[model samples]
Target: MGSEKDVLVAAAVFLFALISHSEGIVGGREAAAHSRPYMASIQVPEGENMKHECGGFVIADQWVMTAVHCMPTGPNGRKVVLGVHSLSEAEETKQTFDILELHNHPDFRESNYDNDIALIKLDRPYTTSVAIRPVEFMRQGGTNPGNDAEVETAGWGSLDNLGSRPDKLQEVTVDVVISALCRRSDYFGSKFTANMICAQRVCPQPCDQLYKKQDTCDGDSGGPLLFNGTVVGITSNGGRKCGQLKKPGIYTIISHYTRWIDGILGLQPDPTPEHSD
Candidate 1:
């Protein structure tokens, strides 16, 4: 076994490699246009360019939820694009909004990525329609769907480990890894917290070697982890290599922070309503 320092070094290396390689979904297929209406692409100004830094989902008329790490310090001319499938081409249904306010979890820390969630207030509200809609969050007291649950994650991140960011949105099915099993992994181990959720691809026979090949990559950070048609988690991070066997992607468990989220949105946590696709 490696010493704690060695483990930390390995973890740091893993994070750095993933961050440098790609920023999108790996092993996911192209999604149907406007299939995920709430999907939002968070863009940050980088010098003279506006780069897509992370993904998010509209939770309300003028609010978006994403990972706190996506904007560690604060928003910098950050804007969100919604109702679009392709990033390069403009769709008539697409709408862009400037960020008015940014609210990160008070306990968020770069170290260990605790409470890695944030909410952004849009400069204006979007007109709800078939192509632009908000997603419902997992209501309070909602049970964790369990390990066997098949969840869908969507993003415009990379399609592989080569750092190739996709122009079209991607969606993939992932299995929820039981917290206990997830906590036992060498990559995350005890670092797993209640605020975090783990997910990975389901493997067939000889699972060990086949477990890899599907995951959220670098550019996917702050995307939605959907279960039962509801937003259950927010993409946070993953292991060094995209979809590395035994290493699962981590997400900010949205249900665990209902109070904080409600506070930020200035609304009470109401029971989740039945939503139509």
Candidate 2:
């Protein structure tokens, strides 16, 4: 609370970046049936029905990784659907569970969209199958993604900004842009932080302006950004619209919070030396 203008600016930023209500997966193709076993559809209780709110991915036996902005605070009955392809069809491969705990990053700042990661513990461990499994995520000491690395993100979000939520899963690949470019005065600028990764769906060589763009949106929040079969980031937020070249999709770098995740998962390393002197 510095000044009245400052407060207004902060509120505007929060509203503009509050994309949890947008649909997702612009300029993407429908994924194959049961192809993405680790994909999770986060649902919240709406009236008497559960509504799809965000996307997530299974990281461990009972842990689902997503963005903090995707989860609801307090002890609510949240549902997760895994190993699903079509939302309209009742597939035999789908696995459902209730969330047991919500672990949002303690440093998360909604006003600035910082540290937007979260880990949700399910009521029970998922049953392993060919169509249901966990995805590996970047841990501490892991290498950062290379410049222009192609990453994949999928969800049942909208196909455009018109709020058309898809009934099936959709996927798109975007190139990782350098932080320096995203931090430019015209781009995200100072609002971009080191803990964030910016990715954009580039047009192919000799492409046209209307060639169609790709990106994550609305219901896609909290989904996995996979590079080389491992999740390196979580879908955080973006600009006013989806699939815009200037407004690249931003993600929460997972490696930066591996220690916190380990503690929550009960995998923290022992402080004592392995061998006594």
Top candidate by lDDT = 2
TM-score of predicted model 1?
A: 0.84
Give the local distance difference test score of model 1.
Answer: 0.83
Full-model lDDT for every candidate: 0.83, 0.84
Over 4 Å off, model 1: 1-24, 46-49, 206-212, 269-277
Question: Which one is best on TM-score?
Answer: 2
lDDT tens per residue, model 1, 1-277: 8899999999999998765343337766778899899999999888886778799999998999999899988887888988878888868898889989999888886877878889999999988878889999885688766876899899987777778888888888899888887678566877787778889884576766523377888799999999989889999987887787777889888877777777777887555542211
Candidate 1, residue 142: how far the Cα is off, in Å: 1.0
Give all TM-scores, in the order shown.
0.84, 0.85
